[model samples]
Target chain A: MIIPAKSRLWSTVAVFAVAVGLTACQTTGGDAYRAPINAAKTQTADDPDKDSGAPTDVSGDSVARDDGDSGITGSIDDYRIEDLSPGERPDISSDEASVWMIADRAERRAANAGNAIKDPALNAYVSDMVCKIAGDYCDDIRVYIVRVPDFNATMSPNGMMSVYSGLLLRARNEAQLATVLSHEIGHYLRRHSYQRMKDTIDKTNGLAFFQVFTAALGVPVVGSIATIATVGSLASFGRDSEREADGYGVLLMARAGFSPHEAPKIWENLDAELGDTPRSRSFFYASHPAISERQTMLRALADEVPIAGGGPGRIGTEEYREALSPHWESLLADEVSKRDYERTERLFDALIADGFRAGAVYYQKGEMYRQRGDEGDEDLALAAYHAATQFIDAPPEVFRARGQIFQRRGLNVEARESYAEYIRRNPEATDRKMIEFVIGGLGS
Target chain B: MKKLVRIAALASVLALAAACQGYTLVKGGSPVEVGNAMKVSPERSWSKLTSGKYEIWTVDGPILQQILFASGVEDGEKLFPTDAQTPKTLPEFKKGMTELEITELYRDTLVQLGGTQFEIQEIAPKTIAGKQGFRFEFTFATKEGLQKNGIAEAVLAEDKLYFVAYTGAKLHYYPKNLPDAEQVMGSVEIL
Candidate 1:
């Protein structure tokens, strides 16, 4: 927990300086920071510390109130689609423009420095999906698919949207994917980032200013960590923004002819995946509305606006599965590597329920069981691997896994046969010499 | 807040002073004993660092390319230092671990070190220190976005794990030093 002090000091100083500069130069007309139209609809205020397993009585209540404009009010039903065309840029103050410029530069630098997935077809597919929901605002937003294995996405004030692969992997269908994308787009359209920044600066007195400076430096991790540290109190402010975004996102999906039910289903799946794990309180979940709360509110909203045709509308599950087919193994591998056994097991169960990529799902389940190595885990692993082999697209590693288990049990003949099959299937296997050596020993 | 600032400033000064100390130079074509359990011969000279439990060696620089030797790590002992009170937990080396389980231990270690995007490219049985062992190839990206490639070999002898890992930046350093690492691994001998 002891971070490098030098880096922390630099980050704190940098953020503080930027916040002060932005505050002094503020000249924006109109309420750029508006309270959520649906604040009353949200049952409880967001308390990240409470959700994160920390005591709720932590100090800094004053900092929590600085989340920009809290007086501007309306209901979720009061929102009307604005003129979001590329030609009709939203009004911005000079100070807001400066923040946007910095964000634009940082995003461009990040695009070059970070591992961006360069799959044109995948990018185009995602962009098209976002456009369907974005309407006229589609041209104002550019999508960047990053290669990180964490379930999150963000939209900066500069109109750059990053979709992490983890989110894509977790999403079961196009509707689910659209739900997340539209939520981020809601943040963009509402100008939440700008408002949040202003609030942070105003509340901290001087401590929060360093956050803005670090963000401007474009040292990715430092800036991000600093923002998280200083912006802890801003979670209440963020909760309001998130609630607003959720409302907006549902409207977007329903209008775009996608099933709104998928929105809540995303959270339901996530809730199940998290179960009672400590990760339920992790930053990813903490910064957003509680999953159960989101699921309930979204369900209510979806019920209010039933699909026009009475049909389920476009779930796009088949198309989504096909599009992500090439990346499935790698995505699944990333999930398995996290070693969160319960979460991974639930994920595999969900995938199996969908009946897509059953072979790979079975294989991954086997891997989880094998890695857990509990008393009865070996039997479970063997059963899962055996099931995997029945499917056409089962990974070749299934044979090797079987061979190892048999070898452990001193079933030499079975192990040798399994190893031989593995060698036959994977002629260019990197561990061919080792497998061959095992076979040689079995012969003796 | 002021107290935090002072403590941080003091820590920074100490860190700077520590960095000023140079590494111990290891001559090429010389045999080296790693920890108390294993020895290896290096064909080329390297710089050695004794920071924690492992003996670290670097050719170009630790950031670009390095080798780690962990010898005689006992049961319930952490491979790296960690604060007991921290929420993050490090995996410990345990006796009676299968090859797959041992690899998982290494994977967990890498994750603790901020290698979130770690992938095992290959794992197979191999001979190390003239005894049955396992070797694994992996790739990972650091939090700072540096992609790394690594190869590791380990054996459990006398109920303790003896391990060596070579890692380098995937862009250029990995391919450049892979042969030298292979040669070093080949020369390993358990006392």
Candidate 2:
């Protein structure tokens, strides 16, 4: 259930605030933007606006292009963050320390999270990919792969990151995943949430602070979806920061030797998935940068960043499929349960086009139509089910579906034949008795 | 100190705002009809809330403990209510659906309700209200990672669905209220 944006506005005052001492430094746009964590008091549980930074960019003069500390005179690409984490955090503010403690708490919670995908092989596979992308900072960031069926990722200020299972289902290739991870890493490198928190505390105090802080941070506009999970962009940072992070993530992907061109399509595909729904999907919409703007900016950045081998970057489609397909059924079930018809329709169509799991995808498409029971959806469901039965992996449920439709239409003979086939293919089916009873009623 | 106080005060305001929801009382030893389809006699008192097609009862609250009775769902109607604002549509109950499909519907409904994990421990035939129905036991977790456990009974009579489920936090609440839930479930009668 989506809480109204207005009511949830105050929830983002400060989920986790980090204070980093900035030093004048010079760097490349490809470099990450992490400042050391110091003492700060932030992160409130149920902070409505704290969790997600919507995908949309805030376009206006309110977004400060040059938000860097003093003497940081350079294009965003050339901006440098001296050290994201230093050995000693001596200058701890009570606020920052409290933030750290809570961040630690959030991390501990992630460690035992029930939705965690428990497959050692899948975990190892993803961890290895994250390791390759993380480089020297890999040790600081802890990754959690959760089974939430939404396209979201989150990086806590304490170096905790969560990758939702739906992200794996949505991303067609390794490169796409890399693009998002690199972006989240870019957020850590950039320290967007901390920066936003710092900006908030710098300006206000008292009840007015509580009232206006979330609004000023642009948290209210996109805070409604923070529970879905988030990373740098999901936390509702200023558009300037989000824009920079988006560019940085693509550049990082390009530098890491994954195909950066796949970056923009993440938003494009998500936009299609959202498909005129009133719900604001925070990761890529209704927040900071617009999808078209992000796509254009990301595409330009992708073109700007040069790859190492000078050949097109690696998409790693085969590697991604091999690593994730074992858990594909569970992931797809969660996806279907979401019941976002347009989103699943788009996703299934794309999967079919990619030849990822044509039979399963078709069958699921039929299931969606059949389950929804909207006008004329049954005919569409039957057609897809028929198409599904042609492939090797088509489930036995397809026959059951056909039988139900036929029985409802008074085609008892056809229904009986279909039920017989369903029972014939799977002798130990869980619903065998029920099917048999129905077939008994539809005698020859 | 000043900043800490400010943040704490803001939290208090939020808590006050959240406490607006009120619950009705279900008296002990009294037979109660829920959702216009079933009646049950509880051994203890509890708080209750009507959810249009169902009724939810709780001791500490829904997060800690809950008993759900969703009965009389007709063919082509949803087993659960839809949030008008969310674009998502819940799957409908159909005629001739089997116990296994019903189990799937429950699982999907939980998933849609933000349950992160569910593992069914058992599904077996059981007698309910003088008729053979299905009973299921399972463990689950919410999005926040809190573990939970539940026991449920379901019967399909005249193509109308009758279901009762009791769920609680796995730590202490489940064990604490399992007996209470069982008693209520045992007293269930189709009205």
- Scored by lDDT, model 2 comes in at 0.65
lDDT at A206 for candidate 2?
A: 48
Identify the leading candidate in terms of TM-score. Answer: 1
TM-score against truth, every candidate: 0.78, 0.74
- Per residue, candidate 2 scores C-alpha lDDT tens digits across B1-191 of 23433433443443333322335799998898888789889989988766566777878766667787888888877655544322143457777776767877777667655565777776767789888787888888866567888888999888899988888778898899999999999998998
Measured with C-alpha atoms, the lDDT of residue B104 in candidate 2 is 72
Place model 2 in a CAPRI quality band.
Answer: acceptable
For the predicted complex of model 1, DockQ is 0.19
- lDDT by residue for model 1 (B32-53), tens: 8877577889998887655345
For each candidate in the order shown, give its overall lDDT on alpha carbons: 0.66, 0.65
What's the CA error at residue A281 for candidate 2, in Å? 8.5
Off by over 4 Å in 1: A1-76, A83-93, A112-116, A147-150, A219-237, A277-293, A303-312, B1-13, B51-53, B75-89, B96-108, B116-128, B132-140, B175-183
Q: Pick the candidate with the highest DockQ.
A: 2
Candidate 1, residue A387: lDDT: 95
Docking class of 1: incorrect
